[model samples]
Target: MKIVEQSGKETGQGRGRALWAAVAVIAIAAAGVVGGKIALKSKVNELVAERGGKAGAVEVDFLGRIHLRDVTLPLGGRSNARIAAIDGRPKILFLNGTLEMTGLDIELPTARILVPHASVEDANLDPATLTELISRKSAAPLAKRIDRFAAKRVSATEVAITQAIAGSEQKTVYRQVNLTDIANGSVARYSADGASFEFAMAIPDGAGGSKQEVMTGSIGQMTGQDFDAAYMARLYTEKAGPDDKEPRPLYGPLSAKAIAFSNGQARFAYDEMRSSGFSMRMPAEPLLETLEKLTSVTNPEELEPEERRAFFGRLLSLADIIGKGDMEMLGLKIDAPAKAGEAEGEKVKLAVDRMALQLDGRRLDAALHGVSMGEGGDYVKFSEASMTGFSWDSTLEALKKMAGLDEQQLETFPFTTLLPEFGTFRVAGIDVNLPNPDTGADSTGTEGYADETGETDALAAEGLMPDAEQEAGADQQTNQPVTSMEKPAAAVPERIRFTLKNYELALTKPFNGIPTDIRFSYEDLSVPVPAKAQDETSVQLRKLGFDELVVSSNIQAAWDEPSQNLAIKDISVSGKDVGSFSVSGLMGGFTKDFFSGDPAMAQVALLGLTAREMKLEIEDKGGMAKGIKFYADQNGMTEDQARGMLTMMAAAVLQQLAADQPKLQGPVDALSRFIAKPGTFTLTVRSKAETGIGAFDLIAASENPMLLLDKVDLEATAQ
Candidate 1:
């Protein structure tokens, strides 16, 4: 009986000890849970305080879930942000979570943006690294920290932004915006739908005054692909080193559809627009800094003249950051109603089928297709126009320089320096149609110039007619005043038409704002002319039996820098069923001073110019015969008589010319033969002096034609 009692006591003692140990373990776990909650809340408050923010009611649950309410944060400068509530579910120690934010609002000095709801799914975040990145106090590479960020999706609903610019308010609203597959602080895709904006401001009225302008615009959809949010953020927040040359793309491709804008005076619309490959050549930090400086100024107008100029120069420097990009727009149209005092049906209309621009480094290439302007029967249209290899480097530099000039200096600024360099410019399939100048309804017509006899006044009043002797001769032959030679007004056309197949200009080399190697040409150009046109040239063309002028011309010229030589390779103009004329010349003594961008300097340099050699050729297809017939009709004589009279007159003039210098005798004889027979004629002129004739000598010879023969060697032939 004694052994049994001892065993039962030992078993009871062991059970009690086991129960106490279990109670102790439960107490320890309970204390740890309370401690973790308190610690998480404290940390939250601490971080908010560190960023100059305040947080109200922070709560943490046992599962590491967090909730915060009434958050207010400073967003740098004069900007502040507020959040109504934030909820986060942490998968690992608050380092990653699904976060939702509600009632978010950001207020700037003159703007405010509001978001009703925003959310991020499966977001991986590091608070410490993010803090460092935002502060920009660390020297670490942006990619390093940005790479640590990732999220499956981020979205916002019903975002609104309102801004006040120049005392005018503007508001923009977006219905739905979202980003998907966000990783490395960048987004694989982004989209926004149903965006609209309205604004009002005062703009220059182009009459030394300002006018109130109201504008409204809308976009049905906007989308971006592969947007580098992190790099862009870094650019705005961090200063780049001098050696940062690697181009960083801001986005892969972006597009907008159903875009439209309208002001009180005009409406603009486009079916779609797209852009891609926009990058930064230099660092973006400078641009950011400049913007900051500009915005920080309380009253920019109060600044000194020099200070204002410096600020403008800094502003212009921002363009240097652009590296390369391309943009295209389709189906663009603009319309403006006729203004007061304008004629009916005179509304302005412009349409473009497509337009595109590409920027690579400092070069820009642009093209326009199917462009038309004006309304009613008066319009200009072109199938295509393009410009390639337009470099903005010099243009930007010139603008910056101008920006730094004071008012006094600007008055005398060398504007020629602002001319930009270009590779090639071409326009094809151009058509222009307009009412005849003479018959136009406007009072600027030729009615006031008519004489009492219903005949147009003599062209001699406009210095268009020949000398008095020739005028008298023509009048005597026709037995009437020269003014009566003009066709009656009833014979004029109602409208004029002009068309061109192509026009092109190529500047292979440009130096000091002048083309050193260039080729300019136009093909298949045609313009109709009325018989009674006021211009002497048009009258002559009509008298030559041409109802329409159809011609093509080309000019190819170049300058040799090393040798100081200017060569005009070809300057040719050809008219259909008329004739063709060409001129080629070589000159020396051209120097850089000729293009020094100063008018005075250029004029001074022109005095030192020298002419070396020149060649002129003319081929008479049928123009010569038409001219002889017209002269015979005007002079009341036969064609043969007219041709003989012209030949004798030319010979008589040549005999006088040969009196001073015998070198011109051969050329004069050849010219007489060409006139009599209506055949091809060629003339060549070479400088007699080894150094070529100076410009001063040429100017002097202009007063005494005989003097020019002494300075040039002449060759002429008729075929």
Candidate 2:
């Protein structure tokens, strides 16, 4: 009994001691809460004061959540900001926190922004760095500080911006915006929905006047991945000095969908646009300053000539500094309403399936696919077109240098320096159809009124003979004098249907802006024969049974800089149902001075050129027979008689040459035989001299054509 009583007493004492310990713990916790509140408030006040801000009531909860009301802060560089309330939970005392801001309004130097609500989750922010960034202080330091920043997500709702510029007000709005995985001064993903803006600017009207142009645009969705916010801030805020070797900042991939812009007269829209690998080395502030200066001028013509030149120099510099990037757009379209007196629904419509541009250092590339313009039967279309390896560095530098020169200096400038190097340019599968003025309808046929078999019923249909009555009226009109202040009716443009299967030009190895290597070719190029022949050559060609000109051509040439040799590998041209002509040759003594842009230097270089070897071949494909028949019809004689006369005439001319220089007798006889019977002909010329015939010697021989035979060996064949 005694042992149980003693145990009860000890248990009661233990319970009392436990209660006291609980009370002490409660007291310590209460003290800690009170002290934390004071410290948090004090820190907030200190930071607010440091930034030239007024702090309102600050409240701290037991969970270390702090709330501030009616806070006003200066946001650096003529900017002020106000927040109705800010609620946040501190992660590490009072230094960084997850923040929610409501009713935030900022007044900037030239703009005002309003945000209904914004939040940052798991944020780790440095107040000093934040203040410096907001105040437009040095960006280098802020960029460094960005490495220390951490934020999992940031989001805002219904953000709006308004700016007043040069008596014009511009507004922009975003329905919702979100930035996720923000850390180390970069954002993993950023997105915005339902964005729109209005822009107003002055544009020159060609008549020494300026007009206000207002444009409104909208974007359905905009998104970015892996955005480098810190780098962009540094780029915009810092000026690039001469010794600044910092690489261009990268801005990951960005895309926008359902983009549209409209002025009063026209509208432009695209289904989607994407950009990747965007970077820029140029400073933004200077460019923006120059643009602002230019935009502020209501009358651009009023600017001094020096100012204009300075602006041009700045533009050139900007072009030079543009770094590497690529952009692409799909389903691009433009529409404009038809003018008065036009048919109903006759509106301008243009569309492109895809357009892309890429810049890599000094090189630029561009491409367009599935392009079409106009509607219905009258339309222009091309399947694809591309240009690659266009380098503009040297060209831009030359222009920048010229931009600083006066008119007198510019007059003597070597304009050859402005030429840029080009690579391959190609366009394929082009087709065009337009309304023919004569027929007042779409004309797909290339032979005017001729049928598919190349037969015309009327002489006028062949474009050989005009209407007698119209010719008489034209003669009378020409004889009459102008008696009134009136102008004659403008001639209507000839409508033509054109189709090209492919066209390509490739150039490389430039010397003084001239391409040393060149390759140019076009295939299946078709154009309609004009309704009326305008010249004698055209009339003769039309008379040769050519209702349409369907041609294909190719040229390949190269120059060896070290050897000063120019080789024409092949220059060939062929016509459908006609014949083909090809020439191949090699020449020497083409120095760089030939392309020096100085006339005197070019003249000297030209005198030193030498001809090595040349070959000319012709393959007749019924065209020669057609030509013989045409001559017969013109002379009102039989085909055989016409052929004999033509051969005799050609032989007489060649015999005179052979008489002067007997070395040409063989070629002369061969040419005469070829003319008598229309067939394949080949002419070959080779320099007899070991070093080839000089151009200067050839020029001297031009006065006496027979002298050229002594310098070269010639051969001709008829088959």
- Highest TM-score model number: 2
lDDT of 1 at 467: 69
Please write out the lDDT profile of model 1 over residues 147-211, one tens digit for every residue: 56778888998789999987889999987899999887788999998799999866566567878
- Model 2 agreement with the true structure over 538-587: per-residue lDDT tens digits: 56778887767889999999998888888999999998888899999988
Query: Model 1 lDDT vs. the true structure?
Result: 0.80
> lDDT scores for all predictions?
0.80, 0.79
Work out how many backbone clashes candidate 1 has: 0
Q: Which pairs of residues clash in candidate 1, taking residues 3 or more apart in a chain or in different chains?
A: none
TM-score of each: 0.76, 0.79
Candidate 1 residue 480 C-alpha distance from true site, Å: 22
